[model samples]
Target: MKNLSVFSLFLVINISAVFSQNHYGKNGMVASASTYASQAGIEILKAGGNAVDAAIATTFTLAVTWPFAGNIGGGGFMVIHTENGEVTTFDFREKAPFASSKDMFLDKNGKLKSGSNHNTALAIGVPGTVAGLYDAHQKYGLIPWEKLLERAIQLAESGFPLPKSLANDFFQFAEAPEKYPEMQSFIKRDGKVVGFGEDWKQPALAETLKKIQKEGKKGFYEGEIAEALADYIQSQDGIITKEDLAQYEAIERSPIQSTFKGYQLYGMPLPSSGGVTITQMMNMWEQLEETPIIGSVQYYHILAEIMRIAFRDRAKYLGDQDFIEIPELEKLLSDEYATELLEGINFDKAGESTVTEIHSIHEGQETTHLSVMDANGMAVSMTTTLEQGYGVKMQSPDLGFLLNNEMGDFNAVPGKTTNNGQIGTPANTIEAGKRMLSSMSPFIITKNNYPFLVIGSPGGRTIINTVFQTILGTTVYDYPMAQAIEAPKIHHQWLPDRIIYEEYKMAPETLKALEAMGHEIQMRSFLGRLMGIKYNAETEFMEGAADSSSPDGGVAAY
Candidate 1:
């Protein structure tokens, strides 16, 4: 494994070419929604940190620079593929508190209660970010933990220039303080929201980081911090307790393993519907009638049709592995099942839509993703979220972070599948200490026993589809990392059955072709904010791309 010193490392952070999605590095590279955080990770890589070390640092830094989804109060998944070809995943996704119930979100008539799942402190699941990062570093990190916290603590104490989008969010919350009682700590310092371009510092968050640096996970999950979290949530009608916080631990799980066209794939498994769904989709693509042509109408049609079927299975079969047994999981990932699934598809016309109207549960699109690859070839793809943007828009004045409304990810009503894309399956029903299902698909692809790509995205239900298409585009269609990342994405979760495409991104003729195929179409401003790195074996360099849809994203490499 080769290492580079900060002063000698040739860092390449080209803001000018970010729109083009072109950035490359010989030793290591990182991509994220925030240029500030990505750059900080690059500095760590240059200072001889491994990918896991840089990823940990980047996650903390995001908690500061991109608080909407980047957070210690939230939880996420991490995928790592070592240079030796071994791969594993970490599941730090939030869990239901011990006091939660299967019918907590239901009313007197057993009907879904509006806002119960996401608009209150009761929606906050016990957080796992601290435990997750600590676990990953303890296993694979080369840099010290305290060193990783330094940048984030400094960023919080000194602050950074406020980006316009973030500034606008604070302004909206500040317009009526009584409407959002807790968000004032973030933007209002003297009763005024921090204006765009001003330095916005968080003194409390810095102190929190310092505690974490000194005492590790206990700094966050025990003693003072833990007491504040439990007492505050209880005060807000939530069920979280200090016991739940202390018992929380990030799990190391086997990644969903599969192969497509000679390339090996490693994806986040179980609690996250991502790995299984993507693995199934990729395996199914191998059984397609013809090779997929990158932007053809036929290509988009095939992806949509496959996604429709896969998502149906997702609604029926996926959940926390710890809670229920998915007997057919092995069979689902089998190549034979993929071939069997193609039997129902009518590429010429369209299969009957299956939008089962039931209890609707959507993971928030505001989640953030980051990718990192150190010089030694340790590649990481991580996705973290706060359920919906500001996450219930609830924050603790003492903790200095927003709490995730992640409990919304659970099926709200049992045994009531509907046509509105609701999945009321018992597997995902609310339960004490159960991890809610997720669509995050952080993954790594390897070619000939070496790292080929590290990729993931933030688009809620669209995540699995986005990841599958990126792999298909880059590996089979021969597209570059940037082109695949910049390409318009297609998504069709089984329940919606409506084909969702990025607005104005598809060719006019292609859109018409899909419509003629009898598929209903919907338009979105964008689908996912993808951040990824693709390896070039011939040149020994890695090419990176950050989603240009979000103006603040960038790639930093050395």
Candidate 2:
């Protein structure tokens, strides 16, 4: 693998520069939501680090540079494929506090208490980011852990101009900070919320990072920082305690493996429905005779139908594997299951459906994803989130970080219809120490035993469909990596029974054709922000692209 580094570097420099919007490099590449974060990963790679090292650097840097989504207070999943052909997954998703209960958010009327679990201290879950990163570094990192913290620490202490995207996010959540005195103090400038382009610094977060750097994971879970976080949450009516933090652990799970059109796909397994849903959708689509043309009416309709079927199963069977009797993966990915699902779809019209007696849980769309690959062929795709923008909309005043409202991800009440019209299943019911079901899907695809595509997105329920479309575009449709990522995407998650697509991203005639087919269509501002890096086997160079929908998304390679 080391011997291939020189050849990769040469190919990266001479790959015809075919895709202008994508960053291409032979030695390494990093695609993330922030330019600074991506550069941080590339720097680690250039400094003789492995893909895992670069991923760690990028993750921490994003915690400082892309606050709304990138985070230290949040939790997520990571899928990694090492050069030696070994694949692994890390489930660092937040867990319910011991005091949490199935009906904690229910009112006296037995209905979900509106906004009770969304933006409050009680919404906070035990954080796992610090623990997860530390575990990953201990296992696979090549650089000193303190080295990765330097950039994030400096950025938090010295401050950086708020990028347009983060600034806009701040502005949108402007009124939120006013409710929490701690948040108000951080964002206020002379009694006004900080505006876009202002220099923003987080001294408190820097201090917290220093502690973690010195004491490893214990610095965050057992020491002064943990005490402060627990005390703050308790004062705010939240259930988090020092014990919850101390008990948090990032588990290394087996990567869900499947094959699509002769290419192998590796994704994060349960706790996340991502891997199963993706594999199921692909299996169903494979039953079709021809790949639908990208952006065409037939294409959208077929994909939407497939998504609907997959999401239905997602709701029915997916959850924390440890707690639920999840369906067998072999059976779910079998051709017979695909055949059974295919029979439910009518290509000529949308299928009629009714809400079932189940619970519908929705994870927030506010999240971040990053993809990194080193010249050695080691690759990583990770999706992390705060559950919502500035999660729970409550910052830990002492910690200078937001707490995850992942508790909202649980089914608050049975027999209730979610805002999206999907019923929640018992499989997702909350329990003490139970991990919430998530829609995050980070994946790595391999061709003939070589790394081919590293991809993932940040779009809550839309993540499965987004990654599905990208894979289809690149593999089945033979589109370039940039085109596959930038192309319009559509989503349909069963109970909703309507195709949601980006406005004007599809041709008017194609949309009209879909309408004629009896499909209900809805327009959305955007569906997802996808980031990916494709390994060009012919050129031996990696090409990375950031979704056009994300204004601040960037790619760096060297």
Q: Estimate every model's Cα lDDT from 0 to 1.
A: 0.86, 0.83
TM-score (C-alpha, index-matched) for candidate 2? 0.94
Instruction: Spell out the clash pairs found in candidate 2.
Output: 358-424, 359-423, 359-424, 359-425, 360-423, 360-424
Q: Which stretches of candidate 2 lie over 4 Å from their true place?
A: 1-20, 172-182, 189-192, 357-360, 418-422
Model 2 agreement with the true structure over 1-558: per-residue lDDT tens digits: 222432332243234223327778999999999888999999899888889889988998888888778888889999989889999988999999999988898888887777887878888889988888889889988889888888888988998888777676666556664565546655655677667777788888899989988888999999899999999899889999999999999999999898888999999999988998899998888889776655556677888788877787788778888888865667887889999889878988877655652323576998899999999989999999999877876776678887788988888876567646535567888889999999999999999887899999999888889999999878887767777787778888876668888764665666667778877888998888899999989999999999877778899999
TM-score per prediction, in order, is: 0.95, 0.94
Collision pairs in model 1: 355-419, 356-418, 356-419, 357-418, 357-419, 357-420, 358-418
Summing lDDT over every window of 10 consecutive residues in candidate 1, give the lowest-scoring window.
1-10
Over the full model, what C-alpha lDDT does candidate 2 score relative to the true structure?
A: 0.83
- For model 2 the local lDDT of residue 13 reads 24
Instruction: Report the number of backbone clashes for model 1.
Output: 7
